[model samples]
Target: MAKKLIAESAAAPESFEQAMAELAQLVTQMEAGQLPLEASVAAYARGSELVRYCAAQLEKVESQVKVLEGDMLKPFAADGAGEGMQ
Candidate 1:
């Protein structure tokens, strides 16, 4: 089973895509450096939250893959593969 990755995705757009989008926006804000110290701190906090969300999602998928293919998962690799190539 693929574990229905879509279930949580629809409920929380905050899945990987949304988290990465927010993280990118946060990076732009930090790079601009126009915000005040307090604002910067706030941005950093929000970014950290997104980081945690992304990490947790990755962990969940990792666990699912493990359950799906135990030892076989380790042998599968896509070291240089690009998106939409498959």
Candidate 2:
């Protein structure tokens, strides 16, 4: 298989969930070892891309949570500030 073809699979996916699922399916198919040489090669390539997409999605989620956590939380105000102080 051409390395360039495999490189395309390493690119990020548009939908994180679908990409992760596809990647997992690819892994299962590989484990089965029933695919032809060409199909196996293509799956390997696609799996790499899905992995990249999944990792990027996770990183984005973590960054967003961190940002929210770092902010000073405010009380609901309507709750009459019964909660703890900031």
TM-score of each: 0.68, 0.62
Per-prediction CA RMSD (Å): 11.2, 7.8
Clashing pairs in 1: none
Q: Rate the local accuracy (lDDT) of all candidates.
A: 0.67, 0.70
For residues 12-40, write the lDDT of model 1, one tens digit per residue.
34469888886787778779877677667
Q: Which ten residues in a row have the lowest lDDT in candidate 2?
A: 1-10
The prediction achieving the highest TM-score against the true structure is: 1
lDDT of 1 at 24: 85
Per-residue lDDT of 21-62 in model 2, one digit per residue for the tens? 667767887798877788788888678667776888888887
Badly placed stretches (over 4 Å) of model 2 are 1-14, 71-86
- Quote the positional error of residue 66 for candidate 1 in Å: 0.7
